[model samples]
Target: MQRRANVELRTAYNAFIESKRMSDPASGLTEIPALNQTLKPHQHDIVTWALRRGRAAVFAGTGLGKSFMQLEWARCVAEATDMPVLILAPLAVAAQTKREGEKFGIEVKHCREQSEVGDASIVVTNYDRLQKFDLEHFAGVVLDESSILKASDGKTRTAIIEAFKDYRFRLACTATPAPNDYMELGNHAEFLGVMTQEEMLAMFFIHDGGETQKWRLKGHAESEFWKWMCSWAVMLRKPSDLGYPNDGYDLPPLAIEQITVGVDHDRAQDTLFVMQAATLQDRIKERRETVEERCRAAVEIIARKPDTPWLVWCNLNSEAELMTKLIADAVEVRGSDKVEDKERKLLGFTDGQIRVMTTKPSVAGFGMNWQHCADMVFVGLNDSYEQLFQAIRRCWRFGQTKPVNVYLVAAETEGAVVANLHRKEADAERMAEQMVAHMQDITVATIRGTSRTKTEYNPSVEMTIPQFLEAA
Candidate 1:
């Protein structure tokens, strides 16, 4: 009788364990219909997996056909639900996505206001115009550069997440999803309704100390955190990361040349010896003081490849003005420019009409594909590594035949800024590798439709009856 009781107790315990296992319910379609024929194999699989998951994030690297996969996902979702789908992109990327849709035989209506979205199956608009449209009308929503959820101001970020919390189908595509900052993962998770940021923190993370803002993953929960992430998202830097052939996805070699313009030590106000700019204010002042010298160095680099297309990035209005003035025939896009003017100039560069383009990374860094231009220049350095990475990726992404050349022109006293950027870059690369390592096998299995999330129950030891029960 005691043995029988023990058997029943073990059965109940096993059942309880199974009930508590982590799982992401499939709110998406069970059977994925035929996808677009034009999609490459990896893209087709990714779209299929996204449709199966219903609401998902595709953290694919740039130039890996995210545009194509997103378009196809929107098309299929619209067709499946028989309701219109909305895709929100960065300012100029909406226009570019519309053009890409045309090539893929998908009609992408670009709308500036809600009234213009009438009867369109797949509508595309910029995030700045999201307020004009009503979310109730669409069955699915796609965020093209979804990283904006974390990068944008808190008000804008909250509005996006709150607006799409209940959408039936949602997809977010971005290359960088909090590469170095793990907390940023909460933004994506909360946006997808997988888990709230607070809930994720409570479950898998621990505060480092008295500081409330900084959190790190708990050591014991590391594997479980990744498992939960794989249930709702797919991250891959390349096709091979998911066991797919990287035939045309290989990026060409990138050559980064750092050019430090000399600063006159005789002009030092407080000290006879030059010191590296240590603070943000000092860095800005240093950049302002040496703009002409840095811009001249950039101009000289551009002259080396006179006819080549160059994408020049600047931080200050003064830098933009000076660089454009120095480089004849160069077009400058500033933050103060009208949205129409910015899009026109950006598209002009993409179309090869503008040979040398000057813009801020904050303006044109997010979603433009400038693989046509193999050469780029940063007039000066900023502390934002993500911006720098995105800026360089514009010209260095896949499909460029020539070796990409990036010139980082900074003042001599800004060595600290350069060193800081390198350190952050290394951290980002290491973190990205860790992220991919944790998610790669699960993502590959998910893409192949064989991934499972249940924690297997294996009782390795015999379940002995408790002494109290035996005595009873």
Candidate 2:
């Protein structure tokens, strides 16, 4: 069989060479490089992560091939257990993951909405679609962009929790797992069933010891808790623990002009915040001018920089709606956009034809690369670090040569969300450092060749350097 295969391959190669000679005499089609070739250091960690059993978390940064890690793990788990794997993600992100799998040459089926999935070992779907199906059939589960579960009442989150209630082989992949607050981590951990939400709050978190119950987080302590908890799971980061060629991406020079919406615009525009539902009406009343002024500014900026492509990230529908009408040539790519159209617009932007593509980061961020536009204009921000990280990384990828610049064109009222972004980035760095310190032990755990319950995390008779995070 080996001799027959070699003869077949050699014949095919010779045929290709003869065919090329018929076309261009000097032409040679060199074999393409492997998609996972020259993987970042953290990428290696991701491979180690999926080899084990139980639940795991590959908390890797953007451009780190996390989807590959997830896919590779799913393949291994399927081979071992012969049970199918289900990957749950957002609708748009599901498409992105499908594309990633194809790019990496992984054969997986994406179940159509409301359709019955077959024996395809790895089945990927959106949260909405996953909610519609029976998840008990899957032996493995991966929650990409896991932070979407931060909102307890979210339809997607609620559906996932209810569906995967009995699921043990869980893995949550995200760079900004807990962006807004530590409470976000509870959902992912709970899905892992490593510790329940109640256990997490009681064990990892503590209230600010002040008179009031203001929440003050304990950062690395909780990180350490995850480290001990995620022996089966692994959290990896980039540019440090995973040394990818950060400077390899040749980005175009970015020149951003900061445009701040001042409070002196009008009575309504001046007032940007509302404390409650009672004030929600007042918030709208106050936003009338502010919203109008921002629309005018969008026009002004586009008119000023007519040549450069502008990406306006508006949070409120009012802002986005107005801009869509005012800017005649502009295209707004939102969550509600058709998958093909959204993909077309993104491809257009990357291919250097489309100039301006206005969108909310929640819609355009994650697994979509618009490296053509090195200059990003943030029209608004939400309480999500995952979106921000994915949004910024769209420009700061491997092909970008120039310095990627993010222009924060925000109204002062959106301070809390902006603060949250900075906090999350800094928090991720510290988590990255803590992870690097224990790299060897984590690597050993992955190759341990045995799965254990939390009580018996001891791999005594197994591979070398058997030490837990608690022991370390």
Candidate 3:
């Protein structure tokens, strides 16, 4: 009986693989003559999976063309299924998706403006705006940077899942879905109807406690995990599995060095208290937000140096707002800007007309090719390794001439945290160890789920102006 059961299981698995290979054949099939010119191999894998599988995930790395894959997959599905494809993304990136379609000669129709979506094939909108639009009207849906919805209970995430529930075809794309742990995989699987968190735990996971249900590793969990993923998601690394298009071009040798900047004792203590302990108290309010002093320093760095294009990475609206003091035309690409503005900014940077472009790593990282500047300053830290690498690679790319230099700016103690990030990143190339240690906490929270802690920065280290200037 056991032998018979094994045979049946193998047969079923083979059937699933067979069914997943063929493309959809329907009356709606309309092929763009220019499709072949733009689609890359990994993108074709996603396109095929979308047409064949009922639902799937395309977990391609950043800078490896996920937006293009999502748009192209949606276009393929639209032709076969004859329904407009709805795409949800972070605001800065959602605006850029429509233009990515045009880069391949595919056009996106604006569904929100119209009373009814027509022969028009593709529609793009942000996750926040997805609620206002009727999601069921579309035949299929694609979620870009799907990790943004990992917190299962958030209004946007719930709205996204509910909206796409009835679609015949559904797909989600992000570089690192489980940047921290296994359970982050649950939401995507549930969206695809492959399994629910409850079902996945019962079938493949070892759960803890009767109430909160945290995950501990099941035996052979990693192997089983990858095998199961074969039916639903595909992940790839760049310049390893896929060769670079500009391999022939000479890239500048990158020299990464660390310089510890010293701070005044009083300022150091205040900053340190603000970063570490001040947040623990009620009366003392701690803020990591920049003051005019840092802006002045960055400006001096730019002004004193001649003709060297500098890219400054900063968080918070006010931090970027200060850059105009140094750069008369400092520009920012936030998740909120329209797609055209992003395109203009990239063109300006490429032409050296825009000297400084302050940005968040996740939004501005992937779609733009910025080989113009060989210098980068990480004014802030994001938990994901993929976002950070994508931001730095803008200059570290193949066509770069001068050796790339990356300056990661942070409070002295936080410098340890930032340095650990780069070392962890370097190891990622060898072992393909998918987990980023610090990020595991957020992923664990999603898996087990607890009320989130409120956060504030109490700078543990501080510096005086004269001391900081002399070091610089």
Best by lDDT: 1
The residue pairs in collision within model 1 are none
Full candidate order by TM-score, most accurate first: 1, 2, 3
- Write candidate 3's Cα lDDT for 92-126 as tens digits: 45545766677877787644443545667898775
Estimate the overall C-alpha local distance difference test score of candidate 2.
0.61
Per-candidate TM-scores read 0.90, 0.71, 0.68
- Measured with C-alpha atoms, the lDDT of residue 435 in candidate 3 is 29
| Tens-digit lDDT track of model 1 for 1-472 | 8778878888988788778665655667777889888888888888988888888889999888999999999999999899999999998999999999999999999999889998999999999999999889999999998988878999999999999988879898998886667667889888888777887888889998987888888999887787677667788888887778998887899888789889988877799788888888988999999999999999999999999899999988888999999988999998889999999999999999999999999999999988899999899777888899999988888887889998899988888455677788889888788777877676544675734333344558866667988787
Q: Report every candidate's CA lDDT.
A: 0.86, 0.61, 0.59
The ten-residue window of minimal lDDT in model 3 covers: 447-456
Tell me the tens digit of each residue's lDDT in model 2 across 1-472.
Answer: 6556556666776566555321101111122112255445455445554444446667665556677888876766666677888887754567667777788777678776436577788888866566566666777788887776873366666667767767656778875554335566667766766566666566556777774434544675655564555553455444444333444324346444456566553434345543321344543443554777667766776676677766777777777888878887777777677766876776667667777778887776655655566666666555556666667877776556656666665444433434555677788667556555565355443433344434222224522332452244
TM-score of 1: 0.90
Off by over 4 Å in 2: 1-41, 114-116, 152-156, 209-233, 242-257, 262-288, 303-309, 335-354, 382-390, 411-472
Model 3 bad stretches (over 4 Å) = 1-38, 110-118, 151-153, 206-216, 239-259, 267-297, 300-309, 316-318, 332-353, 361-374, 382-390, 393-404, 426-472
In candidate 1, stretches whose alpha carbon ends up further than 4 angstroms from where it belongs are 1-24, 210-212, 416-419, 443-445, 448-472
